[model samples]
Target chain A: MLLNQFLLLSALLFAMGVYGVLTRRNGVLVLMSVELILNAVNINLVAFGAFQDNVQGDVFAIFVIAVAAAEVGVGLAMVLLMYRNRRSIDFTEVDLMKG
Target chain B: MTSALLLAQVEFDVAQNIAFAIIAAIMLISAFKMVTTGNVVHAALYLVIVLAASAAIFILLGSDFVGATQVLVYIGAIIVLFLFGIMLTKAQLGDDDSVEKEQRSMGALVGLLLFVVMAFALIDTFGTQEIEFGNPEPIAYVAEPVDANDLPTPVREALNISANSGTVEISEAQFATLLPEVQRRVPGAEVRGNNAQIADAIFSQYIIPFEAVSVLLLAALIGAVVVARKE
Candidate 1:
């Protein structure tokens, strides 16, 4: 019962995150969606860790969190730099790199 | 007869199932809101809800340690970073009319299709099985009593055993027992003293990744400092 519930919720969250990543023009919202995806993955990790009676998955989840923190740090810095240059945070508008 | 036997073998607890259903519902709804909401700050707040729900699910799954870590690290630290990013970037506080509606509609369709496919895959994989929850076997080594002759007399005496009595050894089992009691008394009990197997695996096999995490943290600190540096 619990595993099914968790799996369903994780799928839903990941789907919502995909929608946000694809549809949202704002870079900040895209970052938030990325976090959503990461959270969904973490839920799956912890659930399976508990089910399989293994702590290694939980440990890996912790590593994922660390990597996520680093990713958000670098990603947000880049987003801020783009916002500074373009005066807009929308991805549609920040196509200066596109040839 | 086989179907009936299978049905009898599967035990579903109503209360737990209902509770999990509620938590799952809240998680999905909050996540949907987090993505769909037009306001950035509102989206962050909804993300907090989603994280909290995931943590709750973690606790329900019997990994209290990972669940608490999820709440503390993701909700407390990472979301704060996101909010800071929004502030630093000075994102428009209101919804913009210039966003492409047709693209968003297409993306929603794609997302919905992906959701259905993933859901079907999960159901196909796990639908026939029953999930049972209980205390897992401790990964630490379990100690068994050694022969009386193997232990020194004094050590045997301290364990309230006669020279003829089997040696009551203090091995991984003894440490495992003591560690949980200590954890109950002392908050944030480190797993170092209790589980030697875990320690060995972490220090020997995972050492590189551990150091890499530290390096990543260092990089993040420097990056944040550079980004936040005053012009």
Candidate 2:
């Protein structure tokens, strides 16, 4: 496959993820959308790594994956905590800081 | 006889093109479903399909190790954790009408705008540029001397053109055609597997980042436990 194909795929995925993050009110679903965004970045990194003559892109991708895991773990913990406190995880209703 | 060989190569390329089309179609459809689906559980399942297809794309790109890691890490560990999060939070799995807000149309507009911009940029920059798949000419010019005898005999046979003059001078088209055979013989050309190269690169050149990632993981583990623990 050409590089353009991979790039276009990642672009579409990233856009879809962005839309999900913007529109989804459920906290868990928002987190899942963030995962999609991260996966798109990973795809770009791995594709570049494979096309070029360096392993650094792959290394960066590994780091991205690791960071994404950590992010998801922390994000979900926070979501769970919010659910426990508010009895709901809807983004619209969790406006504790609203003045 | 040469025509027979050419026919086989054409068939292989056609097969690869078909496989890519199928995989990409699946990924795009499921990704669309993941974002637009009403059921949160169904969204998660669609995410799994997208991730699995992306992993398959990684494998097709000749990064088998990354593909496998993606499967193990993303689908195996992370998605399972997501499911746990949903289940623990008492999410209404069957009905998710409340998942989307009134801003959905605006979000779709933004998404479509972003897609158009990104796709245009990618095509404008890379429309005519083709990926040079497996040209070993640069390796002979740049790499430290490799002992042909040390390579597996079949791998040497696959790349024997480079063995004679220490540099293969094949045309780009010929090299492109020969890439799949060489990749089938060895995951990484002119050396050991890509996994080995990636490991060497991590431990040698990027050791600090490696250590940092480990520390990050440890902190995440502790943070998750503390944050989710009973008060």
Candidate 3:
């Protein structure tokens, strides 16, 4: 496969993720969008690792997965707290500091 | 090679490329649906497909270990976490109008702009580099003194060197440290397997970060318990 193919795919996926994050109102859905972005990054990392035939890329990709798992765990917990407090997960409502 | 007329080195496996195209198309469609779906449950379903397809892509890229982890961690655990979040938040199972903003054109515009910038940058920076894997051949000699018996049996017998000989052949790919001044670049041994290399890196150079991640996971675990508890 051409390096461009993988890179272009990753770029497109990342764009979709950005769109998801910008448009989604629910905190959990936005978190899902973040997962999309992370997965796109993993694709890029693995592709670069394959091109170089190096294991470092895969190592970091795995690390990204681990961190993402942790992120989701904490992120969802926060969402649960948001729902418990406000009876809603609407992200725009998170305005405790708003002037 | 500089001419825009000339294409990149077009070496690709026919079967693998076809597989890649098919899998990528599936992932793209599911991901698009995932982001656009109004129903939270439907979006979660779409995410499952996207995550599974991404795992396939990882395997296609020759990182089967990473692919397996993607399946196990992302789809198996993370997606479940997301669904639980949706359920607990009382997200409507039916299409919900409030899931999207009344004026969402900004996101579309930004996404388009980002894609264009990325396309231009990728094309400009890497126009002709082939996506080639390194050969697993041994291509270095340490030039350090070593007993002939220390060499692999095949190399030792093939070289027919005396036991007292100091120099030993080593593949630089196997031993990442290339003693530039003393090492002679030459094909002599085969590089180890891919998973072994990854395992070696994780345990050796990356040990600190590896342990740190474990600690982070533990912290996240405790933090989740503390934050999600009833107040």
True contacts kept of 1: 0.58
iRMSD of all candidate structures: 2.3, 1.2, 1.1
Model 1 segments beyond 4 Å from truth?
Answer: B1-12, B136-201, B227-231
TM-score of 3: 0.79
Off by over 4 Å in 3: B1-12, B99-102, B134-191
DockQ: which is higher, 2 or 3?
2
Q: Each candidate's TM vs. the true structure?
A: 0.76, 0.81, 0.79
lDDT of 2 by residue, B23-56 (tens): 9899999999998888888998999999999999
1 or 3, greater by DockQ: 3
Tens digit of per-residue lDDT, candidate 1, span B18-114: 7788888888888888887778899999999888888888777766766777888888998998899889788876874455789889889988998
lDDT of 2 at B182: 56
Instruction: List the global CA lDDT of all models.
Output: 0.75, 0.82, 0.82
RMSD of 3: 7.5
Top-TM-score structure, candidate number: 2
TM-scores for chain B, listed for all candidates: 0.65, 0.73, 0.70
lDDT of 2: 0.82
CA shift at B170, candidate 1, in angstroms? 13
